[model samples]
Target: MRVSRTFRLPAAAVGLSLTAVLTLTACGSDNATDTAAGPLTVVASTNVWGSVAQSVAGDKVEVTSIITEPSSDPHSFETTPSDAAKVSDASLVVYNGGGYDPFVEDVLSSNGGNSDQRTVNAFGLLESQSQVRDQGEANEHVWYDVGTVDATAQAIADELGELDPGNAATYQANADTFSGRLKQITAVTDGIAATQGGAPVAQTEPIAHYLLEESSVRDVTPEGFTSAVENGNDPAAADIAATRQLFTDKQVRALVYNVQTDDDVTRDVRATAEAAGIPVVEVNETLPEGLDYIQWQTNTAKALAAALQ
Candidate 1:
């Protein structure tokens, strides 16, 4: 099958009133026969994406996520040679584009994995990550947004369904359930948007920008967020001063930040936010274990809403 020349706009757009489910379950029959059922093999870029795929693929696909450890950060990730072999062997691979997981793109370009393998680039499918030019001390954590996650889930389900026709019904059903939760999360985010306005926010990277943007909370974030994220280091004193002053000056409504990586500067920023009574929406480097991707995301969304309001 020929790859699409460009990412297609997902069926659901921003600000829409709910959406249809497109979840795909892992490929297999319930009788412990999926191993014998010849499930579609998959490799996902992030653990969160892997969970989303599992929710949709239920028993239809075998998904192996590249990152599963809680300490893993996409910005700091370095793909190993063994990772390449796993990706190359898969019938399908799902990754978030827009420089989120550059390694995934590298594997696809050089390895020439499978000519017919379905490659789902969720960032490419939904929005133009091209014009999205902000990676500062603010992390580039886009998966926190419900819509983006939902779009990624739909893409996985659609492709898995195409690859395994026999279990399409199960996949669709699972996708439906996942989609419903996403919609509910969206509503929760909307409520957050309604309550909070003009919040001063700063972070170590642009990781939560998409979700921040979705919430419509004013980010009086310092310019350092963008600069520090680009350099992969802490911001300069002046930028930090400006960020801190937002609180001292009483110009900030909240502080949205990443608490995954240990950095004195980020910790300082959090200190400033706390001292100023500014709520800090701390986002993890990735989804934690035990909770599904949807639950993980909703957890962050709830934090954002609380901080903003």
Candidate 2:
């Protein structure tokens, strides 16, 4: 028998039409099975979570991430039969829940073999750790928060241990080491808070909101503008004008642009910021190729710090 859990979508996810949610829920087949051998197989919705699992599991598990390209928008990712197959074969499946990757849930649900698998929903884990609440108010970019990521690493280690008890000690050690690196990443934010705290910044979306908050940077982007962009709607004319003025008037120290979800308005805003000589820092929702979770996040923090300077 397969076990299923109910996850409340974040408030922002309410925009996903009921039909779309139902469609996702109805995807995949119940005949899925774990076919891989030897080491445990892990499937992550995106490389951000995949990297964390890889770090904790080390050479003990083979991890596959569905969303790897930085140019891909995870929100619009379409699941395929291949992805379903990977989910089917995995001993562990990790995903960003809070509707960040509802398709993952759908795939697991339709595929019945997951009852014996270890599944880690980062959003749920963060909620259990008190790093966030299930009030549907939290941002889906939980990886941007160091504390949340640390907790997620520990959770992955624990789950991997349960699946492969022979290497439990090694997994715990790796997780502890990974947690220390996360602390170093947090230190970058601490340094920024000490020197550039309260610096006004702008964003095309809330993709990096958690990191900005940790760094003590004030996000001065118009909420309406960001909400419009995030929801795939045109920003209000007044909101656009107000945001453009923030750049032109040098009111914001930096413009943190989302590289994955560029649109005409966002492009215009970026060009406007550049024209006004405001530094623009590019951020992505997924981890880029070749860089692990710690490297990607640490580099992002360094870039933000440099831009603020």
Candidate 3:
């Protein structure tokens, strides 16, 4: 059995010639050449990642997303025989690793992604943790973290270019545009820090904690926030009590909650923050039903603005 570490491919801005070399090319009438010259086929594990892939690959690659809705728990997501078909047929597969979307892992495990196949694990690219160091207080909602994603996008662009050298220029161009957007977001976060100031933020779960942290904002969630949310388990009563105290006692500036991943615990947390007159910034793991990845991220910036203010 081959175990492909999903976190491997990474970065942007290699040589322009390198990207140009990645462009699609006309090949001789050979079986391998025919396959190599065609449009790239990509499958992202979730819709959010699909949107990201779409932003870059555009018409150059055919992208399909299996998990389009946020309501579906990725942990319990069972792949259909068709998904296996998608896996076997795909040239590229993207997933948000770190055990957050183990379904992708399962798919890849069922059908290995080595050498000929390229797979991306967003979380695996980050600083590794033997035991999920950011657990309890910070759930691994990696898509929200700009730093990690910025790197992930670059990795995808480079690898896709490598996959079909004839389309390298297009891939690099897309990569550049996407990288600019990521940087633009960072600039926006900087503006938030400058205008809104680095306020103490509270969260029901680690929903978008990494993003908040990268924005220079501080999180003051009570312990057990991540573990409970990740497993769909209710937080301990003591933790719940402390979370309530955080609003009244610790004086949090705002609360960021996963609007889609709602449950009794998150609801209670939102209520506690609301009752305490704290503003809320709702976040979603999967892009909202109609909104694509970029628009959704733009909305996330707006939410940050509201909460920071």
Please name the candidate that would achieve the greatest TM-score relative to the true structure: 2
TM-score of each: 0.79, 0.86, 0.81
Query: Which runs in model 3 stand beyond 4 Å of their true positions?
Result: 1-39, 112-115, 128-139, 196-198
Give lDDT tens digits, candidate 1, residues 1-309. 111111112211211111111001111112222334455688888887888888988765678999887566554455666676566556779887766676666555544323455687777655543346443332334576565667677777777677777777788888889989787677777887777644556655566776777676656666665456444555677887887787777786667666655467777767877887877777765567688877777788888777666
- lDDT per residue as tens, model 3, 1-309: 111122222222233332232221101111221354565688888888888888778788889998887566565565665664565457788888766667666555434223356787787766544265443443457888776677678778887887778887888888778878776667767777777666788876676776676677778676586456645667788888878887766478888887766777778778888888888888876778787666777778777877777
Residue-wise lDDT of candidate 2 within 147-179, one digit each (tens)? Answer: 778888898888888777789999999999999
Instruction: Give the C-alpha miss distance for residue 110 in model 3, angstroms.
Output: 2.1
- Check candidate 2 and list the clashing pairs: none
What is candidate 3's local distance difference test score?
A: 0.68
Could you report the Cα RMSD, in angstroms, for every candidate shown? 10.9, 6.6, 9.7
Best model per lDDT = 2
